[model samples]
Target: MTKLSLNRRHLLKAAAIGSVALASPAYLRRAHASGGEVNIWTYNNFVPESFKKQFEADTGIKVNVRLVDDQGKQFNLLAAEQPNPTVDIMTVAGHRFLQFIDSDLLAPLDTGRLKNWGNINPTFSESDWSTIKGNKWGAPILSGMEVLSYNTDYVSAEEARTWDTLFSEKYANQTAYIIQDMMSIIMLKMGYDGNMVAYLDKPEEAARIVEEAKQFLIKHKPLVRKYYDGGAEIQQMFVNQDIVLGHSWNGPAAALINDGFPLDMTIPKEGSYGFVYTYNIAKNAPNADNAYIFLDAILSSPEIGAAMTKASGYISTYKDASNHLTDLEKKSTSFTDEELASLQFFRAEANKMKYGLIDPAVEAIKAA
Candidate 1:
């Protein structure tokens, strides 16, 4: 029973801040039949230790968690295991979850086994992101938007609500952007002068538009204090007052405030990137029955959702989790369900491909 700490520095580093590795531990190459224990693989700092203990206490099934360094590695691990895999459940993001489903690496979830399946917000439960062709692949457990986060002492709510604040000369050499998720930066660049909607509406121009966003980033490089890949690095910059505004995911921003920093995250006028984290059952799960038990445990109780949010700094997907959040936690993440679903964002596949090009462009510009 390794107790993993959910600290800012540790979580960001292990979150695979940018990409995934092609290989995983060799021990997981083959599948085995159900044993007394259930093996789960996921990113670190997501589920709290207490929750794992409680789940065991309730079901009497010992849980073994394997930490994944990157979200990309989840698929790589699955692809390596092939027909039979030892992992029972994995935490896959919506985009990667789709790929898992397409590859037949995921099993159709039996909603009848999930007591709280009916309680999930209909918006997520009914969406194609979690369900496809009458089969549900996973349960949406965490949700959040990559919002514009800033130090309140330096930038007020009014000034920080727009994308302009990031590129303004007032904060020249004092702004930072997470280069890891280049897609979000591309969207920020496209919306800089209000050209995002027009650009996205034309998919054929994705390459050209992305190039233009790279050039835009280069143009504002002078204003940027530095480019970062990990959320914790950006959080450290804020704590040291090295940056006033930058690109940040909601969880890390929330973590900052909880640590006593005056940080705030908001959806910019152009909109922010929204994502859903899912718990997927491996197609060749060793303990399929326990997988269902875990999913039901998370969704059926607000306490579980609250614990997840408190540990990961992201908002809960469970509808009833709102009853458990503190006033401060609620204020840190102010996005509504409509806003999360309505944000003009790119799909994970598209975003991943765009970043392939956007990454080198950023490097070249930074060198220049």
Candidate 2:
């Protein structure tokens, strides 16, 4: 598997850029683009610079991107700037798409205009997260799955491909919880049968389920060597040999293996948790025409999708894009049919309630 090369300069550039201070001139200038531009608010480096240039060349519309780390902040900025909003295009995780839809922040999509919409993986296009309330508010653009990632030098592929390994005595104190969010671990403890999002549809039942999920984490606390608050720490721990097996997203796992860390991710037999970042046109975008044109050009073209995947570790939502990716890129970003059957994603609105309930529950568990 060939790994996409990452240079020190790129890493530094990514780390140095943070969210433009809210309401600053830079933020204001970017939030509102001229008629000739399509203002976009997305994660740093989520869109490939090369693709943006190509889109600009094909069409007269100039692409303006603003980097932000927090998806919640996207809504905050939009809400503050409403009635005369600046951002024309917004990209958010699939799980959080509903929040914007519920708040009336997104424009109803005309999928017929997106020529390559059909090329997107059915798993994404058909997902409730992609199409809510009978309207498509966002297009799934990037993907990453929460799979069992471990240092291969320490754990064999067979041993790492099961949820049971996380609780086993063999790797006890050698396992780590790298993800800050507890939803993945909570879902695993729930046996992957209960829908975390179901809490929204059936609150009474979900409330009880939430309690059980928290207790499950407390029970497994002894098995964890450390509970990391971020991905970088988790990667550092794995590199230092502090942990043999831990939970990880596919993108980071791919980067680690490529860095020669002897690490890899496995879709556990018990299943996996994954997420997709979707592209949505703002409800009051100034250049809605250009936004659709840009979306179609980027999301519909396999080559363009491949460029984004290559530039960022995240996978493309369009499945045909896999044809343009190398073996390692496919292995890192794309999942097989069997893996897809086992993967589950949460509903953003329902998950908001879950996060609210789980946060304090986790605190109490850790305190105990």
Candidate 3:
């Protein structure tokens, strides 16, 4: 597990200066005048320092950030702190929200409190993951997709458009990917629906499909150089010329491309899985009002969204965020309508069974 780190010193310093800022007679107050702190737990780089400073400056709300490196770890910590979570807001993936909801770790959002809520893209706001049962549990902020990426200097665009390129004899030992994600995409390439929830009623069919994908991966195991876990690991592999083709999250590959690397990513002919990351207020948060204000500030400006996208390489959820992006930034991050339509967004109902089948299968592939 990745070590979890907290920026307590920064939070302490912010708190120390809070009284001084409040004492200023000329201090400007924004739409929400509640002056308090909002403690956030999110992945590194997901929150830009510039945005954080700007948010504090504009609203006088102190932002205390804690960096969580692993999703499972974050969930565990939140569970352990139940009923009195230290985090006011945290980032949760669309597919993983169900577990948090079932555990009663999240608070239902009152969108009426967020004055800039209308700036959210309908594609995200209308998703089943965002609205559970009749309550809005989270506000979608960014999205990323699994993609086929390759070094353009070595792999042709035509070759990189299909998942088969990773297993081709021509690129043996030159490919890499996260094992579970690779298995999922291979299933899609094999003409399966890739919807695990639909197979829950028929566990036998799910088992059969998973076994097939497992066997296929074992057969092509020699073609792969490594099965990586994190984005940074894969990015470094590409930089060191250890991998010329691989499966990757669009964000890491986009960051490389934007940095003038001879790399590019595609959705592939078989389509791919995508997920939206959202900001949710914790249940029984001490500063729920401040959390609402923080969410509103994130949605209130296209420039904030743009800065977030540039920092993290994820597509922003703000409707007009792209207006502030450069052509290359847009090219690396934004998807066309056709491409968007081809993606299968991760579903909450499928979370358990999807991992149940895929996890053991991946371990078997690794062993073989």
- Which pairs, if any, clash in model 2? 31-86
Q: How close is every model to the real structure, measured as TM-score?
A: 0.77, 0.76, 0.85
Supply candidate 2's per-residue lDDT for 296.
Answer: 71
Quote model 1's TM-score.
0.77
List RMSD in Å for every model shown: 8.4, 7.1, 6.8
User: Model 1: which residue pairs collide?
Assistant: 251-313
Candidate 1 residue-wise lDDT, 1-368, digit = tens: 11223455644443322112222112222323223667889755565676666556555678889977456567888889978898999988775565677788989888888878876776777786666768887888887667888888878888876778888999898888765454454555465312234445456576676677667777777888898865567777777778888888788788777655777777766676677878888987988887876677667666667667766678787777767767876676567564455364335444445545565776777786
Q: Which candidate should be chosen as best, given TM-score against the real structure?
A: 3
Pick the lDDT winner: 3
As for lDDT, the candidate ahead, 1 or 2, is: 2
Per-residue lDDT of model 2, residues 1-368, tens digit only: 22334444544344223111111122223433324889999865567766666456555578889986557678889878875789988987888777787788889999998876887888888876677788988888878777788777778888876778877888999988742355555565566334465447777776677777767777778888987654555666776677888887676566565455577887877776678888888888988888887777676556666666665567777777778767766666666687688776655656567656666776777786
Give lDDT tens digits, candidate 3, residues 158-230: 8977788889999999999888877778778888857577787888888899899999999999889998877
Worst 10 residues of 3 by lDDT: 18-27
lDDT of 2 at 365: 72
RMSD of candidate 3 to the truth, in angstroms, is 6.8
29: Cα error in model 3, Å: 4.3
In every candidate, how many clashes are there? Answer: 1, 1, 0
Candidate 3 lDDT at 202 equals 86
